[model samples]
Target chain A: MIDKEQVHRVAHLARLELQPEEETQFEGQLNSILEYFEQLSELNTEDVAPTTRAIDVSNITRIDQLKSSPNREEILDCAPEREGDFFRVPKIMGEG
Target chain B: MVSIRDLHQQLINKDRSAIEIAQEALQRTKELEPKLRSFLRLTEEHALAQAKQVDAKISAGEDIGLLAGIPIGIKDNMCTQGIPTTCGSKILENFIPPFESTVTGRLAESGAVMVGKTNLDEFAMGSSTENSAYQVTANPWDLDRVPGGSSGGSAAAVAGGQCVVSLGSDTGGSIRQPAGLCGVVGLKPTYGLVSRYGLVAYASSLDQIGPFSRSVEDTAILLGAIAGYDPQDSTSLKVDVPDYTQYLKPDLKGVKVGVITETFGEGLDDEVKGVVETAIAQLKELGAEIQEISCPRFRYGLPTYYIIAPSEASANLARYDGVKYGFRKPDSNNLINMYTQTRAEGFGAEVKRRIMIGTYALSAGYYDAYYLKAQKVRTLIKQDFEAAFESVDVLVCPTSPTTAFKAGEKTDDPLSMYLSDLMTIPVNLAGLPGLSLPCGFDQKGLPIGLQIIGNVLREDQVLHTAYAYEQATQWHEKQPSL
Candidate 1:
């Protein structure tokens, strides 16, 4: 069974903040589901390559021509914070 | 009102105006939506505007293509320019897109009306609509039961007569399961057959947009309108887009139907199993040669899907860092704190759980033990399907193990809710085309779905066989007593 510490670690890694009760509940649920998933490790996969996509296609490229972008104002309108033609955010790299 | 063909003919003959139909559908939605709760946002202005455009085209004597002025419900996950596409989560609650999805774009070019944005499981993660952070879509057949989701609202809108057809995305039985429970026709076309350009990504490779409709012919017409190659989506197939309506004939004389053995065994409810068995016999009666086939790796599908979908979801949903769009928690010390709080507060429980599981599966030490192994097993499951298809033109099975359960019955136990898609997940795993139509009813009169799966790109055969069975049976004609 997974411990609360591990659950907290995973929640942090997933960028989610969980309360004490949620962490406990997650530990139980995750352990049960992960236990259910242990069955996959038992399968013989010695020579099988991983199948990432069901369809066989790759390197699909369009012509190297520029297309007009979508209405930028409409998209930028959804931003929570923004400056002149730029998305505003909490300080990054440099201190506020 | 039931037939898209008759509606289209009337529309062409000037017997009825698109505004008249749109107003009636709007009124019908106004009355039933309180009980059904199938929609997240009804696009009354947009739908009426599009109806006016169709009316203008008809008045000008210009030919409007298929699905002209047909009122259709769209799943909330598909982006509509300036319309809310929330994916049933608060994170994207107010995030309207600047552009349209390829499927909806195609629909608009074909002249269909966008009636509303339908409800769904959060980010298409759960089997029941209870996972929706907004509202639980009730099954029109039995208001106390779920419509079966994450396309529950799409199915309910079609079943409740609020729309003639609807579009839903299937990442695991999202379209087919709800359609089965709601007694409508839902088709998850072959993976690349439908483009996913502007769809809010759930699990990229497993996802495909398809149709939910009252009849097979309506489904075909809607499928034709929304399907075709789109350069916008990298995975969109370049194959010829067949006029699917041509395949709607009730003829399956030379078809070979394989009954999946894994679908019938333990865990399948007796009533559902009995309905599936009867549907199989009825198919045999319609000139389909039935054979019992084994897919040894089929049982592994549920676990494998749980791993792969969440793993992909973790990657896809990582973009929601509360940076540019959507919700942002006000109280946060730093950027990282803002991300954690925004996501933790914004996303629903199921979405967060899947994100956590995915993060754990794809985490450093466990990568080899979980994600990679699940992908390898996915191949084995695919191979099992490939072998089954070598002898059969189409595979027949139940869409769900049971009818729509009581609203909160499986919500607490996520595993039990996950089991609802048992019979339908293998199709997604294999990237095959699958169609589910009303086959029979359980003891309580809830509809049972008969799943017809075809090999990759063999949707014609799947539709042909379903059309035959649907024509043979009286099941699809029965409306909910609502």
Candidate 2:
């Protein structure tokens, strides 16, 4: 079962701020989702080998060749805030 | 009446001009645009100009490319040079792509006239078109109901006959589910079969572009045009793409078809199940052997997909800071506030929720428990197909649990919205090729799609079998009375 504290914790970890009402709502919803996932635990996966891929395909990387790309100015032109060659924004970390 | 082959015949016979078709398609778009809302942007002037070139080529007795002058719809997620590539998000409202995606470039080279970019769920994140920041695209079948999304507009355009075909990207049923709801053919080709260069990434590992068409032959023709190696998409396969249209004969004499047992559990409505069962019976009559197969790992597909998809989404969406290639807030005093306010104001609620969930799953301590663990689980799901495919050439199931639900019904419930793709998720997780085509309709007359999944790079066999069934049945001939 999920609690208000767990909801708050998950939300914070996700970088989302949740209100008290949201925490209550999430507690019930997350628990319902968790309860559904519990059905997966009953399967006998002990002797079963974990399969990673259906296709045996590998080496899908394309060659590193220089191609004409959108200009840096065109790319940076849409930035919400800019400082020369870099995007500028509020300080995310503590005072520097 | 305008099949790809027939259009080719017309172009070859000099009876009908490609310019006329383009002009007619443009006029039809003008009539339907306000009511359907399928397109986010239409490029009629450029389209007609391209059509004129194709017509001149025909007039001069010069060879034309396949899909020459065939009008098609492109999903908004695909980057079109000089066209807005919004991905149904307000964040990039004014952003126009300066470069063309490899897929779009290939289609353009083939002389396919793109009518416009179609609407979709925001960031291709939701199942219903209701999440679109621009406008809601209605199901052509029933106007009040949704055209299942994030490729809803693509499906609706094809189903509504706005275009003979359209392009869509499927990351966990984005293409197939919408097609299923709209009564059209949608193929989510094998992973890496088509280039992903400028197709906006939703869940990078799971996303691949495919075609939505009214017939399996049209789907194969489009697939042939788009499926090839590109130096731009790092994940694109380097293998030779076989011409899929040549393999459309309705004869699967000795083929083996497996019906996955796990997909038809308690969730599917009875009407949908009945339609699928009837299709299986018809396939048996067509000289193909059918069997019931169990892949126990499929049960875990939704959970694993939810974890991996959101985790990837969280990382991919991190680039949309207000300062870089998306919407920004003018009143922001500082950098952090700029990012926060821009994202908060720019992205829709669904996009933010997914980012948050994805962020949580990939967080420092939680990565091993959630993201890593889900990847490990994804391995098991892929293995399920590996073992099952060993005994069968292909697997078949219902594409979705039910037909199109009302647009806003599940938007409020994210988990229920996620369930809309339960059957198709495993195929994406396994990276196998899957196709969804109209098999029959539910009691309410909405389309029921039969999903045919084959081993990777076996799209030819998948299409062949589906085309065979589609020809044997009258289902594909039924069009929505819009």
Candidate 3:
């Protein structure tokens, strides 16, 4: 049974800011879903290996060579804020 | 409402110009747009330009591709170069992709004209397009009902005669469910059978791009254009791409069909079950050997998908912070605050809910109980398919539990909406190819789909079986009044 505090904690972890009413609503929704998920406890998967991917292909490496993109300006243009050639963001560190 | 083959023949015979065909499709789309709300953005200029190129090739006496001049809708989740690929979210509402997706890129290379970017549930999250931040795409058969989603617009466009065919990505039944509800042919190819490069990631392990069309033959033609290994997408399967159209035979002789016993009872609507059962009987009459096969772990697919998809989605969508492309909330004091506010303001409710669910499942003290357990259960489900296929060539079931429901019917209950994909989700878990085609209509005149699922990489068999059944039925011949 997840509570509003836990819902808020989950929302925070997901980098989402939920309103007070949304937290309460999600508390009910999440609990019902989680409770429904509890039905999986019936299956005994004690020795079963987890299937991360449906197909088994691995080590897909490409040659590490430097190649310049033709659309560098177009790529940079998609950024919300840019400083010349780089993406601009909020300050990460306090003023010394 | 012509098939791709007929349109292709018309172009070759010079009976219709590519520009004229494109114009007719665009004009029809405009007429249906007010009622269906199927497309997020119509690429009229780009479509006309592509049609002109095809016409130039025709005038030069060069052989054109099968898809040349065929108008098609693309689900906005795929990145189309220079086109706004919104994925039905406010976050990407203005985000124009700089590169093309592998599938759409291949489609364009085949000379298929891009009609527009169709709407979908935000980040392809919900079972219905109600979760779309832009607009809910209405079911073409009935105006008040929803076209099942998150590929609702793609399916609706094909059914409403807005486009001859379209492309949609399926993760947990997005393509098949909407195709079922909209009365069109939709296929979700085996995972890794189609490349995922430039497709905005939802659940990497489960996502697959496929075609939506009015006929199985058209679907086969579309599938052949896009299925192959690409150096860009490492997960793509390295196998010979067969000309899928060759496998479309009129008879199902020597085919062994399995009717999944678990899918018929309980929550399934009686009319849907009856329609699918009749379709199976028709398959048997077409000389298929029918057997009742039990995939016991089938019902567990929903909960397992909820855990696996959201966990991966939480990781995939983490890239949507305010610093990069897409919507950014202004005036944040710190880096973390910006990410929180941007995501909070930019994403719709269902997307946020899924992210939260995924975060909780993968968080500390809960990972072992939720995510790991779900993966282990997923192994059991895959084994169920493996064991069933040893005795059967293909599996048959209802694509969705019910026909299309009213637009706002399942909006308040997320779990109820999730149930819409119950029959289709397990196929994604096992990475199998599944195709949905119209079998019959319910008493309400809503369409019911018969799902034909094939073993991994056995798309030829799935198409063959669907083709046989489709040829024997008149359901595919009927189109919506719109």
Question: What C-alpha lDDT values do all the predictions have?
Answer: 0.90, 0.84, 0.94
Q: Write the per-residue lDDT of candidate 1 for residues B1-482, one digit (tens) a residue.
A: 36898889889999999999888888999899999999999999999999999999999999987689889999999999888889998999879888999888888878899889999999998888888999999999999999999999999999999999999999999999999999999999999999999999999989999999989989888887778788888988898989987887776788999999988999899999988898898888888899999998898999999999999999999999887899888757678878888999999989999999999999999889889998999999999999999999999889999899999998778788888888889889889999999998988989999999999999889889989998999998999977
Instruction: List runs of model 2 lying over 4 Å from the truth.
Output: A1-31, A43-73, A81-96
Note the chain A TM-score of all models in turn: 0.84, 0.74, 0.90
Candidate 2 lDDT for residue B14: 81
**Residues B239-331 of candidate 3: C-alpha lDDT, one tens digit per residue:** 889999999999998999999999998999999998899999999999999999999999999999999999999999999996769999998
Residue-level lDDT of model 2, residues B1-482, one tens digit each, is 36888887887888788888878887887788777789898888778888888998888879998799999999999998777789999988988787889988988888998888999999899888889999999998888899998899999998888887899999999999999999999999998899999988889889989999989999999999999888777677788988888888887788899999988898998999999999999988988899999988897888878878887888788777766677876766656556666776678877876776677667667666566667777777887798888988989999999999987788778889989899999999988889999998877888999999999899988998999999899988888776
Docking verdict class for candidate 2: acceptable
Number of the candidate with higher TM-score, 2 or 3 = 3
Instruction: Give candidate 1's fnat, 2 decimals.
Output: 0.73
Candidate 2 chain B has its poorest 10 consecutive residues by lDDT at B332-341
TM-scores for every candidate against the unseen true structure = 0.98, 0.93, 0.99
Model 1: colliding residue pairs: none
lDDT rank order: 3, 1, 2
Report model 2's TM-score to 2 decimal places: 0.93
Tens-digit per-residue lDDT, A45-69, candidate 1 = 9899989999877889978998777
Q: Tell me the TM-score of chain B in each candidate.
A: 0.99, 0.99, 0.99
